[model samples]
Target: MTRPHTLLLAATLLSLAACNDAAPSTADAGSLAATITDAAAATDVVTPADAALAPDDVPAPERFSYVPMGCTHRVSAPVGSTSNFRDDRSTFGAAPDPHDVHVNWPADPSSTIAFLWRTDPGTRATVVQYGLSPTALDQTAVGSVGTAGLMGNQVTAHEVHVCGLRPDTTYHYRVGGEGHWSAVQRFKTGPAPGRTDYDVRFVVAGDSRDDVSRWRQLQERAMGGMNPPDFEIFTGDAVLVGFLQGQWQSWFEGARSAMSTVPFVMVHGNHEGLSVNYLMQFAQPQSGVSSQDELYFSLDYGPVHLVVLNDTPLRSDYEGDVLGTQLAWLRADLARARANRARVPFIIATHHKPAFASSSHSDEIDTQAVRRGWAPVYDEFGVDLVLNGHEHDFELSKEVDGQGREVSGRRGTRYVVTGGAGASLTTLGAGALQPWGAHFESAHHIVEVHATMTRLELTPRRLDGTVIEAGRISLTPRAP
Candidate 1:
């Protein structure tokens, strides 16, 4: 039987297709439409009103159906442009020297780690040497290489995966081929899956566009702490222009110190636009959505489940109903996370746009659209926190339900905008403090989260180490 929400979506899509002459062809819609249809057919029907409720209230899946009105193409460079970075050997050395090295967990965070780096086009070997001790680097992992055209410069990206690692253990590794190798860097693997006894710490920051110096300072501060982060959740906009090779080079150079050891879980920001640079630089877990795998993904670390969503969709090759497709995947993802609440007690969602913020982007169409579409799902799943960026300021919302109303105690999700990593600050607008706003600040800062099985303590700190109203949330494990 066809669900009411599915009928609404089909009607909406048909209406948009008929009225909007600029809409992409049905062929361009790809399998996403079918994926949504399949997802909807498997679930019970519910209205938007039925999904919004307090924590103790019965939960229902959110009904969100919206086709993008007019998908605007945002890629700055011409599509299908080939890279020419190797063409200029005088500027770029002929040797297969590697740079811009970083690490990510594309598989199990406890047992696997993927190393990504860039070398000259001439490089043929993609290898990583590692061991339990830096002195005895005995093991080797071989991987494949690919090419990307960034700002007219063609460079090779190498990805090597090292697995069979021990949980909560430290290992030293280096990436490169032959004579051009990077210095040995060390990283600690995550705790065993479903292990809630171990504590975890991570940093959340974003919007470092056009300010490399400030970003360098922020990275230094984040890594210089007595208890450095296990990893970083970057809210996106790593460069002023995502497609520009020089900007990315600068961004990576600034972060080389921290990124070499601490892996980054990135979100796609608007400044990244529709550039391939964003996709080429980092390796993310597959979202099982065919070609849209890298657009959104989720991972489990210690006692927390981190869901990363892509709310920034511009004109691109695979741009049909992005939010809708993500909504379907998100429902299933959160459902699984909810079922495993006994092991992972917290669900933290991160994305580029803020659903609740008092800054410049508060009233933007995309912000409101995300709020309308995803909030109810978050409320239904009892998401503990939603961290966001793109506002260029810091704002924390009181615990609120899907209807944007404050709920008693810990009955609703807390929305936080932590977009002040290194971007130019934007002041809160007049009357910016809404009833749901708990605090607002326009300073360069990063949010530190300390998570345990029973509690999560979050602190937003300035560059000078000043804490901005630390908040804590206590949790009781749900039935498995």
Candidate 2:
């Protein structure tokens, strides 16, 4: 007589076989189930070859399946959550118009992605259909909808969170509901945690306010080549005024091509301020802090640990110690990342104002405050790189410690101010290049970063493909 566990395994196999054209014999099912059991107990190690297989070539058991690693799927509150709303704008027989559709990672970049789009305030459907193939979007995920008070007008913003995706895989998806849908768009997920076999690529850009033409050109160049970046890191100042709906619309229209296919990791800039408009537009991972959830957070992609902070000073009317609370959170977050440095070797921090820059804004009050408060924290945690914007120029600093002393041999934090996406260029300030400044230039450019287990390379290039400067950081092992 067969055992109960064996019978259960056989039943599961038969159910799976139903999806295929043919089912195996009873004896064959028993043999296959025993083989699967032995394989499961053998080992869980994934080899380099396994990581290199194309999405279509992955083994059947693992294809389109979720790898459980204790991830919590959380969706952000819909628009109008913080502001007063008008009447519902939905009509009885109107076609859905999904515009400004974009994607971002609100959870683990490897296993989850958040999609946001806008429609008339009256539209109500909030759904996303996705799958590995464009023709076959068999899986569906429901989301929430809310209204946003854009200037004096109201628009409905739809946000959907899709989780349990395979790492380094390309997926096609569409958003809508009630039998109306948008065109299909494709995006690739980031590499899995502790996986060093794949190279991670991304673009760093910022300060594109008031220059829609230039912004479009920069994005076209960044996403034109055969090998585009996995995602983009926008250093903020995306619009001239954060609360103005027109500016936000223009900014998204300029980034439509790049944002449609790759996730954007955003840094809140001074221009955006603390407005409900900014909060309602983008969905980001919560920082677990009540007041500052999407305002500042951290995420891991490939072997790099990225921390985004809100270094801008609080509004005069707001209460509580925003900066102090963020500092405490930073210390704890960096400690956790440092403890796991053996797996993710690089710690990169990004904010709006620069801790080290030799440009027009270098001597401003906010920039100085950011330098005084945050530079030491970065040094204490052995952060490898710091990225910033708001200078409207390009500047890269030598390795510097918390005390404003230059430390050579890659032992200190290196800062780069890459705020040349579209805003008018500004020249370096008089006597701004200090001992720690390695390079400075006033040009429209973007920084392209390529990261592997043992090496990280950053190349800043102008719109015309001219190389502004290049730098590399070698991975150093740390003790647990």
Candidate 3:
């Protein structure tokens, strides 16, 4: 398997990695013996109510015509280590898991965090609780998941965010039916570096679907290993866009271990967010009223300034809006980043569709338009790099200047499309390279980005854990 493929598969393997009673090998693809778990955590001192069917409350599978989507984590312990994880083992005819659960840590990785999950259809009452110690869980919150009225609604979910956590700390939690609480799970908040100077590792990929593919299994095991990344980012085309809710829920359940603890951030792809379900499922920072579908926003992590925008802006033609509101906001946000320049030295832009992709449909987008509008802003604001996904292939663009020349001048913008995540590869015509595309491959893969004040490096890997493409850039915060 290639490197990106290996990394994608790691997610499934991580669940069993820690249980093998040995330090996980960064190279293994086989599953190890490990414990399994779920989510029923109420964002409170104690779970407000039990969503899972009590032992006596559960109906026999033969009684209902519904397919089973079992109960998840049960966070009923008193805010400490006293909780244990388990499963209600809900079963329907040939069903894996139902009732999609979505979660996030939006409170700036500080004292408070948030999460969302899907409950049994028509079941509104639920519970979640947490504390440093199992004996002191005095916090509590109340929320419901799914359509309480529909009989066959497969698109229901539960959402909640936890708060008041100590920085750089780990706390235990559980969620589920009151009688069958999930095994207590643990998660650590982001490290509180004194002044945003620290090193962090995150994994990148796109186009992974939950409908059971060989590539999906490979990617799952690759991403589920012991030394998992800080978080996972899906660039775009994650799946056929425009589907109703719950379509991507299993994708979330399949990678619960890594996602529950790690903040999984997603950028709107050409395939997602047409409906409120997608946006509501994944909570993004408030992008004040920008055409109701302000599918763009920005965030600050440590010293890095990340700008996420929607490249698929509304247009009657094939190209995106040239002077639309998105561009204006991009200009203003970037300008503000320059005002307090030194605090954020690394500025990156992430969108679903790429400005340049070497896949079969490379010519679909108009490059001159991007360069004409956004590239200049990147040049003016000292933007270090641009990240995107759309093509079902992996690419790492060389550092280049505004004119598409190799950049030896400054921390100019470089583009990369790491989308071999799990979808079938979209073959290119040949060794086709665009003006700014540096390295390109037609392998299923992911990207691991490591950045610091002095340098930015990217490693693009295929599903089998092979580093097909790699590149680096050097720079200081100021314009050269």
Candidate 4:
């Protein structure tokens, strides 16, 4: 009647890949797999909510619903083969990460939310028709930037940001299209500025490629399980450059159950760089801290300040990646945090590559660009924590003060790299093992971060839905 709780262990992963033995069958998983596989073969309708493999950007319109003559711009897409599950549509034509929908608004409780998404070139101007109640779709909102579309292989992305939304209010919206509007979606703005006591959640994961089943497991645990996260942070490299579209699509549609219910805060990963297609397709937080040039920005959630940055270009910046432009912005932001430290005590960041990897990648400097650029700021300001994905393993580094010295009593920034979400694994205990090596698992996993004013909790899911690693870090105000 009930399925075995999947174990987030290495053995479960081996089964998914048919690596060693048949994936250990749970009591109900086999039947569930068959049903899902059957659904995959039937080319009916799939939407963003069901989590089936489909378009990456928009959740499929309600399944089985037909579009009008010009509802959708028919671009070339290979029909999937006759299989229940696969990480790659290698048999199909090149699969690319589907264009995405990016939504955000300031924590100024009364700020109108901004909803942005990309569409096929065939569509004209983008607008979101939304309202608190789904039945009364009466509220019509517009974007400041008139119709903006960027071209890729066959389609173009449309970006628009709407404002003047009430803080912490939920509104349902549909993107522009001739047919039935995109599956009705909804999002709520952050609590008003200076208001910090509220509940929020954002799932964090990175380096998800190839082992889509592992990723699926993560979605199951995060969204399908008892509790779904509030939003999500895609730390980066959700897929590879070449031969990555299928992987990207899998990660997207597969996670629809979660994304449809929650918002995605996407951060550029190194793998995101190689995938020119990624840039062309997904619309992101592109203003203020991000403005037009860089994909770096700062946002506020209840009692937290969240920063997202690009790792690839930090080195090429005219002055310094973390020191110059980003540094200036970070300082201004931190200064604000300093004054309002009472309201927002936690400062966190999400970047793709990790500065400290204790696997086959431990000593490589290429991955430490963020550490090189922004370590000082983290040290100077007493940032609470940083999340990264790259290494094919999960690790919670030792607790250390900004200067890299291991701290004992309190007041330290913790660096955690949850790269095991789906990337290949490597041997550990060989390099860069910090005294802070609290937990390490040489397996596949998804990173789960939960925090409150007192402390932060991190748990990495092994493929079978079991926790492979866990760590707790305490947070406190800086000693003046």
Q: What is the C-alpha lDDT of each candidate?
A: 0.70, 0.71, 0.52, 0.53
RMSD of each: 13.5, 21.0, 14.3, 13.5
Candidate 4 weakest lDDT stretch, 10 residues: 73-82
1 against 2, candidate with superior TM-score: 2
Pairing residues by index, what is the TM-score of model 3? Answer: 0.70
Clashes counted in candidate 1 amount to 3
List where candidate 1 sits over 4 angstroms from the true fold. Answer: 1-93, 314-322, 470-480
Quote each prediction's TM-score: 0.79, 0.80, 0.70, 0.70
lDDT of 1 by residue, 1-480 (tens): 234334334423432221112233354244325434444543332222112211335543321111111211111112222232211212233867778889988767887787888877666577788999999989877665555542233446667666678999999988875667788999889999978589899999898876788788889988998999999999977765454456788889989769999989999776665354566667777665433446688889998999998876533212343457788888999999999888898899998888887776677667777888888899999898999988787888888998789996577889989888787788876656877788888889888889989888788888787888643334444334
Q: Order candidates by lDDT, high to low.
A: 2, 1, 4, 3
**How many steric clashes between backbone atoms does each model show?**
3, 2, 85, 18
Model 3, residue 324: distance off in Å is: 2.1
What's model 1's TM-score?
0.79
Ranking of predictions according to TM-score: 2, 1, 4, 3
| Stretches of candidate 2 exceeding 4 Å from the true structure | 1-73, 76-95, 150-153, 316-323, 470-480
Q: Which parts of model 4 have CA positions greater than 4 angstroms off?
A: 1-112, 116-119, 142-154, 242-247, 274-276, 280-283, 287-294, 314-319, 429-432, 474-480
Q: What is the per-residue lDDT of model 3 for residues 266-377, given as tens digits with 9 covering 90 to 100?
A: 7766555233345445544545542223357776665567787765443311243434666788889988877755665678888766665566545443334565667777
Better of 1 and 4 by lDDT: 1
Cα error of candidate 4 at position 136, Å: 1.3
Return whichever of 1 and 3 wins on lDDT: 1
